[model samples]
Target: MTASTANDQRFREFKMPDVGEGLTEAEILKWYVQPGDTVTDGQVVCEVETAKAAVELPIPYDGVVHELNFGEGVTVDVGTVIISVDTDPGAGPVAPAAAPAAEAPAAPAAPEEDEEPQGRQAVLVGYGAAPSSTKRRPRRQQPGVPAQPAALQAELNGHAAPAAAPAPAAPVAAPAPAPASVASAPAAGRPLAKPPVRKLAKDLGIDLATVAPTGPEGIITREDVYAAAAPAPAPAVAVPAAVAPAPVPAVVSADRERRVPVKGVRKATAQAMVASAFTAPHVTEFITVDVTRTMKLVQELKQDPDMAGLRVNPLLLVAKAFLIAIRRHPDVNAAWDEANQEIVYKDYINLGIAAATPRGLIVPNIKDAGTKTLPQLATELAELVSTAREGKTSPAAMSGGTVTITNVGVFGVDTGTPILVCRRVLLRHPW
Candidate 1:
């Protein structure tokens, strides 16, 4: 129920919501707003990916963005504040202390009567936006030194030392080594740098311990890391005629290979596939059916007046046949409830269509395939496939599927035994 800053009632924080039911975390895919951007209520500020699908999160209140807590591709837990907004930008900028005060655990608590109602606010995703109860642990403070503002710290680390903080006068004879030692050994212990700067140094294959620090209080900056990573110029001096140049060593370069961190939809898909493969019994049965008649029917349906704007293909007829088969054999459309130690039979089928997308393989389903006409089915299928391909499928669209149909022929693959989606029956159609 605690706000970011009780004194600044204009500032409001938006936490990462559980976009999917029981989803604990989501990776930020993209940010649509930056600090100082004016945003209206119901404006989409960012996109995130959970285990099931990609979701766009809209800001619930109108305001100017004050700050973004995490960068893209960073996984954040539910109930964590992701963005802060200044609802009353006309009131002028708040003091720098407001930012750090949000993180300070020892700040004076507001009276319980003054607190805003902690009821859930309406949002596009999840049940609603629940107020974030998560708090930062208090940081230990030195006796006399005051806590530094984040902006001031960033400014100090980004520029040269101020003229007011001149170095103490040393003997003229020792001036040369003083500059060298100060540049190379800025700190007596481990190298000092922000998390982002350290990550940059690591990605560039630069050793922070060897790179010179240029920021205040021995902090290493991004520029220093790049400087260390840059290749040194070759010496211009020519070798003597009597001396042979030393043979160059055969050193391997890091550029020969690339490493990509697995996260987001791809990461979730991998985890799910692994779990389904090892935990469930995989039965791969192949039946080579004569699809010549079905293909002819697809061509005939393409010219039908009712199906003019609808997608008519072999997959459509195959999916319709599969639904009919499920209707006859309802026992095939059921899931084992492990917790309840029972088989949960479903009367209505949420038919999942597995589509290979740039993000990964996503199986978004039609809500009730059993109750739709052929044209209705085709329309929904086209919309679902297009949405999945565009990486815009919602989590709800991908959940509660009783059966799935995957068309491997689209990828030029004859056939494949795809792992079951959530232990449901899967049918793979070959070319």
Candidate 2:
């Protein structure tokens, strides 16, 4: 075969796999391997942030990196082609693939018009099931109204709109257009503001239609909503000569404020916390305990050869005591099944240790923690903390916990009412 033909046959596309259970998308945090780099089977090529955690994805086969389909920080849907590789680069000089007329991220080939769409495609990792479809549902337009293009709709909705068509290669050399006069009001229809901004305006009892949009493409921003909500300045009265005008305070510029978009582990944590707060009835009981003997025992364990190199901290002792209490009272280590209207008691304990990391708060559990010895627990705890701190904790490590313990004393806080995880009891330890 010719070099071009051989290269075409050797190219393999790698799709984004579902790293977390039932997760539909993930943001590309970092790419470890760039185009033209070599890769081996099971070699980590990139790191992605899912709703559950930050996970490293490994390539499934050995190859020379052909292309990177998406850039970092882009949130791509599962099953989209993320990278391509030339498995047999030694065959000959690889021919550059022709770019399509439409400029967009690489995606899986669509089925023929006559061919029926298949179910979920096989994923890159472990041959798991990928998403059945990545196409979005069509938006409903009002009667007698013409349908707007996707990019225009996105712009109207106060989102960063994508280009409607590919731009010219030398577009930057083109002459700039004159700036248009700002509109006093939005065009006829719903006011253009993001969902969060709309919520804020509603909460502040302000009408969005009355708020002048200072954002690009006539989109309303939070500042616009706030300005609209501000009470009208009192009509100034004719002041007497003796009455001195009040000094004006220094005005802080809005540019100083920073807004971070909620996503990934932090977003998931917030949703889970809100759901937990409303769904579960929480009751906290505080008690004083003398831990002088416990501290001495911890020190003694640190000196023991069996516990050498193992973490022997007060938290370990607290976890041991909590496990023992659960052993005595098994009813406390159970979850309520609201659907079945029953209390499901667990036969084994998966003890979760809540650790706060740079990404967010994650509760990774040690499987069958109740059955492990003190030394084993210490070893696992140390490894867990290390893994979590490095942002390498897998989704499996954070799931299926029967009970959880969070050490509030680590932050020097006396106590806190921690929300329950997975509807299981959470014990907060404080020094």
Candidate 3:
């Protein structure tokens, strides 16, 4: 259906473009169009979420949307064909696809948990999308058709005119711009939020597309989102509908929680955390070093003629201090290999610092912290901070930590017991 009829009217299927500006890819959150629906170039077709934001995909061709390749929540590479548009290359092409109806059904009660996945028919990748609506909306005007509302038809062209005098000299043809098309193209329905807010949502992996728009012109503003956060225990009320339901609402608990099944990065984090917590008999000691001493060293280093532009920071000192402390407490940094039945004490300090991410807490250690110069450590620290904050930290950078010093002092309220993995014995999988 997306095929263009004119030989020269080539159909250009717009894959999900990287609208995030130099960002890599996005998750295909949902598609608005299916086969047989009309679409116009520049119309929004699907919604995608990246590591940094959620965005709407504008259809690139004026045609029938032939297929939707990806379903909700399946992340596809940028430039991937999530939808194909069919069109006639001629000046007057077919009308664009109509807007989709609400994706949710009107059910008062939640369905049983185990059955939800089995009931939903996923798109190509089997990524789950919101439930489909059984009902359809009324048809709207199509391309090459009038955009005028149906009610205005009684006073339309020629109905009130006299047919005499050669039909009144066949009223002189006047030129006017064609009416604007209705977007309704299988809408991914991301409420409008500007690029920066979108970026924030993407960074948080928040689905702005479904959040209620409280801003003017039905846009989802950043403030709206912040309010939506904070108290996260509540499942959002189903999006408002035209035929409003008349039931009294129940106030649910304000607990921030979601029971995600153990898998992927989370599963790995759990195993690693548990291992680090119990295996090593974690004896976390805290000494709030008036990091004043380290802070003074940083200032001195910054002013040094040789260290100009080295971008000195307190973390550099912490790394140095950790290495210094390691000389005395090398025992704190060793790992036990259960299978080999050996105590693995690493001589080289692969000093690892841990940070929190949208995925989970990740501990990426500095490679050979013992060998790098002050400048090198500063550079590595900057690179690591930037990459980890951007959620692009590599896995290899995370493993094989001899010992680690976590800067909880940076959190302002310092001093706490830290847990290290306890390896009960060489035989029991490093509990």
Query: 161-247 in candidate 1: lDDT tens per residue?
Result: 444554566444422332333445544658989999999998998888998888976788998998999899988897787797778
Error of 3 at 130 (Å): 49
Q: Write the number of the candidate with greater lDDT, choosing between 1 and 3.
A: 1
lDDT agreement of model 2 with the native: 0.85
Write down the worst ten-residue block by lDDT for model 1.
172-181
Residue 24 error, candidate 3, Å: 23
Please report how far candidate 1 places residue 329 from its true position, in Å.
0.7
Per residue, candidate 3 scores C-alpha lDDT tens digits across 1-431 of: 43333422444566777664454666776677787788876888876655433456687578776567777767678777777665653445544555568788666565554344444554665365544432334455444554453334424521344333432333434556555334322236646788988887777667886577777666678887776654658776886687777889776665655666544345556776786665555443333346567678888999987677667877677677667776677665666677898887767788766666665666677888887877888888878777777766654566555666555555665355555533421110000
Q: Residue 326 in candidate 2 has what lDDT?
A: 88
- Candidate 2, 1-431: lDDT as tens digits: 66556666799889999887888999999999999999999999999999878999999989899999999999999999999998988877766665659877677678765443555554466465333443445576544454576688778655667766764454234345434446544558789899999999999999888888889879999999989988899999987977977879877777678889998899899999998899998888788899899999998999999998888988999888888988999888888787898888999999999999999999999999999999999999999999999999998998888998888877777888788875675555554
How many clashing pairs per prediction, in order? Answer: 0, 0, 27
Superior candidate under TM-score, 2 versus 3: 2
Question: Candidate 3: what lDDT?
Answer: 0.62
lDDT of 1: 0.81
The better candidate by lDDT, 1 or 2, is 2
Cα deviation of 181, candidate 2, in Å: 36
Error of 1 at 319 (Å): 0.4
